[model samples]
Target: MLHIVNKSPQERPSLDACLRIAESGSILLIEDAVYAAVKGSASAGKLAEAAKKHRIYVLLPDVEARAIADRLVDGVTGIDYGGFVDLVADHRACQSWL
Candidate 1:
């Protein structure tokens, strides 16, 4: 399963809710949700822990747009638009946390 979140952790609880309910799968952070992948951010530690059970991905373009490319967490992977399409195709299903 692919759990997609596009909200900022600082502004919304969508990421937290998804993390709590998703047991094992992939997580793709798009839009403002890319903020969660930044090092030293409030949600970084939680995201790091989640990475143990879930393959964490962040949209490269989104991260670049936010100018947070250099601060991404250790285990978080960055993907381009094509990679995003591949992820959706690879997963059997996806849930978007709006």
Candidate 2:
């Protein structure tokens, strides 16, 4: 399964909710949710913990747009739109945590 979170952790509980229920799957952070992908942000620890259980990814364009391209957590993979499309195709299902 793939979980897509598009909201900021600081602005909503979407990311938290997604992380709480997420198991051994994949998580793709897009839009404002990319803020949580930062290396030392508030959700950094939680994201790092989640990475141990699930594959974590962030939209490369979003990270660049937000100007945090260089601060991504160590294990979070940055992907482009084509990669996002590939992920959707690779997974059996996708749940968007808006």
Candidate 3:
């Protein structure tokens, strides 16, 4: 399963809710949710912990657009649009947290 979150953790509980419920799978942070992938953000620790059980990814373009590409959390992989497509194709199912 793939869990996709596009909201900022600072502004929404969608990321927290998804993390709590998703046991094991992949997580792709897109749009403002890329903020959660930053090195020292409030959700950084939680995201790091989640990375143990989930394959954590942030959309590279989104991170770059936000100008925080250099500060991404250590374990979170950065992906491009093509990588995003491949993730959706690789997973059997996907849930986008609103």
- TM agreement with the true structure for every prediction: 0.98, 0.97, 0.98
For candidate 3, what is the lDDT?
0.95
lDDT by candidate, in order shown: 0.96, 0.94, 0.95
By lDDT, the candidates rank as 1, 3, 2
lDDT of 3 by residue, 9-90 (tens): 9999999999999979999999999999988889999999999999999999899899999899899888999999999999
When summed lDDT is taken over every stretch of 10 residues in candidate 1, the lowest stretch is 36-45
Say which prediction, candidate 2 or candidate 3, comes out ahead on TM-score.
Answer: 3
Would you list the clashing residue pairs of candidate 3? none
> What's the residue-level lDDT of 18 in candidate 3?
99
lDDT of the structure predicted as candidate 2:
0.94
lDDT of 2 by residue, 37-97 (tens): 8877899999999999999999999999999998888999989999999999999999999
Candidates sorted on TM-score, descending: 1, 3, 2
lDDT at 43 for candidate 3?
92
| lDDT digits (tens) for residues 8-61 of candidate 1 | 999999999999999799999999999999899899899989999999999999
Off by over 4 Å in 1: none
Alpha-carbon lDDT of model 1: 0.96
